[model samples]
Target: MVSEEEGKILIRLARKSIESYVKNKSLIDIPEDTPETLKENMGVFTTLNKNGMLRGCIGYPEPIKPLINALVEVAVSAAVNDPRFPPVSESELDDLEIEVSVLTKPELIEVEKPEQYMDKIKIGEDGLIIERGPYRGLLLPQVAVELGWNVEEFLYNTCVKAGLTADCWLFKDVKIYKFSSQIFNE
Candidate 1:
């Protein structure tokens, strides 16, 4: 678990990375004093919110690189590369509140019936990942709380995000994975 101080460091690093990229098109060098725990290759996402609305969100959902490295990469991507929203502008930096979600590895939820999924899911506590063939989608844990959606709605939306039908989870070939996150924001 990350302490409050560590979380704040992550937020600061993310903001610096975004600002550096926005103003000069360069990634910030990870600070020299970064804590070792913050350097673990954990699954991490950087979210940018402006005036309380989502501006952009992106990250490495898998532990593919050091958390410090992933922070710099995804923070910049969220600022300029999220296709759902336009690139964040330089003026928006001051108003942008940054969030970091460190995710646990997603575990496939095995159940005999689609109805069983509701039993396994824990709304605000669990994130969802839906996959079928080559398509996949992920919805972070806070998404449900922010949108006030129940399990069914969350599952359906994740399927759509994966470019599949809302009921795709009912199919035998589809896969459902659930994960928890350590979330912090500023």
Candidate 2:
């Protein structure tokens, strides 16, 4: 578990990175005092909200880089590259809330059929990833809690997000993965 102090440090770094990138087209240099726990390879997501609604969110689903570096990269991307919204303007800086979700590596959920997924998935706790062929989609854990989706609904939405039919999860070839996240926000 991340200490509260470390969580705060991560949040501040994400905020600074988003603000810097939005205002000046630059990424903040990593801080000098980053804790060793934060330097470990970890996947991270940065979410930007304005007035309690999603403005932008993006992340690495796999642990490809140090937690701190991935956080900075995704924080900036969430500000400007999320296709669902327009780029955040400098004027919006003060109003944005930054959330950082540090994710556990996703583990494949093995089962003979789709129905078993409900047994493995825990609402408000497990994030979902559905993949088929070249298509894939991930919904963070908080998404289900925030949207109040039950396990099946979560599966349906995740399928649609992967650009597949809503019933695709029922297909035997589909792959499902679950991961948990440590989430904190400003």
> What CA root-mean-square deviation does each model show from the true structure?
1.0, 0.8
Q: Locate the minimum summed-lDDT window of 10 residues in model 1.
A: 59-68
User: What is the lDDT, from 0 to 100, of the residue 8 in candidate 2?
Assistant: 95
Error of 1 at 138 (Å): 0.6
TM-scores for all predictions: 0.97, 0.98
lDDT per residue (tens digit) for residues 87-178 in model 1:
98888889999999988888899999889999999998999999999999999999989999999999999999999999998999999999
lDDT, residue 89, candidate 2: 96
Model 1 lDDT, residue 169, Cα: 88
Compared to the true structure, candidate 1 yields what TM-score?
Answer: 0.97
What lDDT does the true structure give each of the candidates?
0.92, 0.93
Best candidate according to lDDT: 2
Best by TM-score: 2
- Candidate 2 C-alpha lDDT tens digits along 1-186: 577889999999999998889878998999888999999999999999999999999999999999999999999999999999999999999999999999999999999877999899999899989999999999999998998899999999999999999999999989999999999988
Candidate 2 off by > 4 Å: none
